[model samples]
Target: MTILNETATRTDRWTPVCSYTDLLPERGAAVLVGTMQVAVFRTFDGALYALGNFDPFSGAYVLSRGIVGTRGGEPTVASPMHKQVFSLVTGVCVDDPAVAVPTYPIRVTDGTVEVSVV
Candidate 1:
């Protein structure tokens, strides 16, 4: 399992999860990296976001099955199990400020989606 060190510098290696074409607009897919299940999303505007696949409210690995949408112009995903909305960029829960998911740095290079689990 890869543990992310907050104090560590931003020199982590990016691992390719899937091809860009594998993702559809406003949808999410689950991918495994190390011991983590990550949810990857491609917005309608062709932007990508990655976050932890675990839904804190439901205590299930179902964030990838969430519905992608926007709240106050912020990209968000609503957990399919409990309907908790989370910000795609920051992973913050909109309804409950105390809850938040882990977010990963993601990018697209040469039509591939990559994420850093460091």
Candidate 2:
């Protein structure tokens, strides 16, 4: 998996996952990017985030089903299997900053939530 940074890079051919309207507020959506399973989230504030759906610790496919909350206003998601907390924006483990998760850059263009997989 890769954590692409569109803000610093170019992705003119990003793949579309879902309409921005399709995402549940404060919920995460599991999507496919060329066979890679991903968890794309729409925060309560309307911000979008994307990360690998697989939990590195438990090897579970539950990041999409994880809980959403904040710590001192930093948005986060908890792993359902072991309750590992990770920053939605950076995909960095809050409990242990050394741990990293691939965080993809996302955008909503014309109501579509698109992500770069290249």
Candidate 3:
């Protein structure tokens, strides 16, 4: 595993989560990294995104079960519990900007999906 710190120097350290073939386009998958549950997504355009799986409104680990779509050109996922849409790139809740989830850096190397959690 590789660790990366968010600071003046933006360095990316990736940890393999799953195979790229395991993910479906425009869908989200729940993955466990350490004690955190991460929601990994593969967009229709072949873009990959990762965010915390916990939903702030419902306090449930169900972000991965949310619906994937775009709102005003920004890619987003709607929480399954309360339908709170969240930005996939920034993790900010669309309905309530103050509430947001943690977003992780993700990449696909070769045929595997990797996310930077540190």
Candidate 4:
């Protein structure tokens, strides 16, 4: 897992979290953006997503350890603690629409994965 440090370049509001190659397909990694704990995911098709690491259902900062998969074509991550699935695109709970986690805007510049925590 890569952490944001002095070496990472900041482009406007986006902060560099890790290199695109550092993330494995269908896996997640946790990184600290200021005081926020962000969970970064790379889908099997090479898509990238960023969500808040806190699991609302379990009250634990463990979303980074969730199982990555899909639901009706939507990329998702199932909370490891309670098995609550969340949409990687919108961060909405798949089982409970009213419940949701925060999603961050992410993009890759060159080969680095950057997320906007602003």
Runs off by more than 4 Å, candidate 4: 1-12
Candidate 2 to truth, TM = 0.89
> lDDT values of the candidates?
0.86, 0.82, 0.86, 0.88
Per residue, candidate 4 scores C-alpha lDDT tens digits across 2-117 of 32321223335878889899999999999999899999999988888889999999899999999999999999999999999999988999999999998887888788988887
Best by TM-score: 1
Model 3 over residues 1-118: C-alpha lDDT tens digits? 2222222221256678999889999899999876779999988877888899999999999999999999999899999999999999889999999999999877767787877777
**How would you order the candidates by lDDT, starting with the best?**
4, 1, 3, 2
Question: Each model's number of backbone clashes?
Answer: 0, 0, 0, 0
Model 2 Cα shift for residue 51 (angstroms): 0.7
In model 4, which residue pairs have backbone atoms overlapping below 3 Å? none
Better of 2 and 3 by lDDT: 3
| Sequence-dependent TM-score of model 1 | 0.90
The whole-model C-alpha lDDT of candidate 2 against the native structure comes to 0.82
Give stretches of model 3 more than 4 Å off. Answer: 1-12
For each of the candidates, the C-alpha root-mean-square deviation to the true structure, in angstroms, is 5.0, 4.0, 3.8, 5.7
lDDT of 1 by residue, 47-86 (tens): 8888999999989999999999999999999999989899
Which 10 successive residues of model 1 have the least lDDT summed? 1-10
Shift in Å, residue 20, candidate 1: 0.5
lDDT of 2 at 72: 71
